[model samples]
Target: TLPVLAEPRAAQDLGDWLRELQAFNLSAREHAHTPLSDIQRWGGQAGQRLFDSILVFENFPLEDALASAGRSGLRFETQGSTGLTEYEMDVEVSLRQTLRLSFTYMRRAFDAEQVAAICAQMMALLGAMGTSPAQTVGSLSLLGPDEQAALLALGQG
Candidate 1:
């Protein structure tokens, strides 16, 4: 999924941006699916390995019909302590293409709780910006009382 990392001050134009992104994704899919007339050959080093991971997101309105036609579930075991990591994330969007939620799955790279907390902060930021899109990003109250308290404690350290 495309990551739309936007500032609170840009919230006033978020709807427009999402609409554009939706159109872009559709066009990109169409182009990607078209058969290539000539295949290009590439050379790589021996023993190169490609890794795969599964990600799943709850039902959302913006998902393609084919992708959401049946029940959604993901179950897999992650490799332990690899020096490098592969990207794995899932994002849910509203009918209007507005981002609603995200899940980052990387056992070796990041703490799940911390990632979830960041997602919560994102939701709070979106809510605050939705109400006052004209406000500066720094002026927005993106953190709840608990998060604020934690931040203050960190500052005291």
Candidate 2:
């Protein structure tokens, strides 16, 4: 995994932001083998985790691998717990025929409601970006009409 520093400007459009991210990812790939500890130390963040959340985009051909394993009389079973999550949240995006977004979050740090809101916001943002890639990052609205109306009602009170 590459440790990339995503510094996107609010005034930038989604397309621009994506391009910048792509460029950073390409550059970071060169140093992908660098130790995370070394990166943390170099960034003056020694003994501290750089990020609390991670997004994993998986596009591997797992079906083929599973088929091969089955042919060899080896069955694979999914484990309920890996027992290793240094981050507070993990978003796994599985790119199959349909996109699947799975979130694993620390219960102590966040409740189900908060995670649900975050998921809703993410879906809204993605929908907005898809519809209008030229829209500026700051101009993008994370709230729906009902949410905006509710907030407005509270503010007016």
Candidate 3:
């Protein structure tokens, strides 16, 4: 889990946005369960595990939104590994359903393009919210041996 910043305001104000958030979370979760057009969309076991983890938490019993909800939230990120590159995202756990958005950054390095996309996704939680954009800190190392070869093949293609 990302270290909780413990914004006293987040506790107070987060409840502030629960009504709208619950609706969005419901819609996002529905989209998640729909059949995938592509096989890669299933992402095998690791991706399945992440999705399963987020689903264990159910929305509050209310058909209406929970104004003071316990856990509707989400987490998403981009990463790389072995022979395949993948993107993963899921809604967070919540008393009400949550929307987690995660994705893999496919490449040797994470860059501004990736950061921008993430920022846009965060804004989705609340129609009105603040943002502290990030700057990529340092150089990145090579991809794993298999991924490197795949990239090389793509470049040559």
Candidate 4:
């Protein structure tokens, strides 16, 4: 069975997790979209607040690579998040020899096996990063899967 963190079983911890989830989204989006050079220009942060908590596997963009492929061409994309940050990914398919083709995608690959491997790896890293139930600080119940999903999206899960 997939290992799961039981809900915090405390209201205060859940509340803290919620707030952290929100902040995580804001920071993640800012980090994901801004290019490395621009990030260098901005002192490494855009000073935005995190938004949502849920990490709905989603898409971002395939502008640069797809544009190189030209219009009316095939393009594949995928999306995922660490417990702290969200990401958009594209698959690069290439043929090395007449009978050999290979694919490399860093985000959530359209390929199921790749996706599973990366997701598991990401979740493990998230755990290593100390992103479990946070201090709640209020009267509330334990955070649910819904909240946990959000927390995971923040690159904090």
Best by TM-score: 2
Candidate ranking (TM-score, best to worst) = 2, 1, 3, 4
After superposition, candidate 1 runs with Cα above 4 Å error:
1-88, 96-99, 153-157
TM-score, every prediction: 0.42, 0.86, 0.22, 0.21
RMSD versus native structure for model 2: 2.2
Q: Which stretches of candidate 2 lie over 4 Å from their true place?
A: 61-64, 67-74, 82-84
lDDT of candidate model 1 versus the reference: 0.52
Worst lDDT run of 10 residues, candidate 4, spans 93-102
TM-score of 1: 0.42
User: Which digits, one per residue and each the tens of the lDDT, describe model 4 over residues 1-157?
Assistant: 0111234334546546656656766567645755545544465435542221223332323345566666657665646634332333322222323212122333443566855554555445434334444544343323445545877789863
Minimum summed lDDT over a 10-residue window in model 3 is located at 132-141
The alpha-carbon deviation from the true structure for residue 114 of candidate 4, after best TM-score superposition, in angstroms, is: 26
Candidate 2 residue-wise lDDT, 38-58, digit = tens:
999999999988888888877
Please give, for residues 1-157, the per-residue lDDT of candidate 3 as tens digits. Answer: 2111122233334444444456665656646655543323555533232321121243453333443342466333335544222333233334435443333343544565864555454444232232211211111112444555878999999
**Candidate 1, residues 1-157: lDDT per residue as tens digits?**
2222233343445555545656775665545643322111122323432223323334544345545544465333445643232554333334345555546466665688867876788777778768854454456676966888999999999
Decreasing lDDT order of the candidates: 2, 1, 4, 3
lDDT of 2: 0.82
Which residue runs of candidate 4 sit more than 4 Å off their true CA positions? 1-14, 26-31, 44-157
lDDT of each: 0.52, 0.82, 0.39, 0.43
For model 2 the local lDDT of residue 103 reads: 86
Which pairs of residues collide in model 2? none
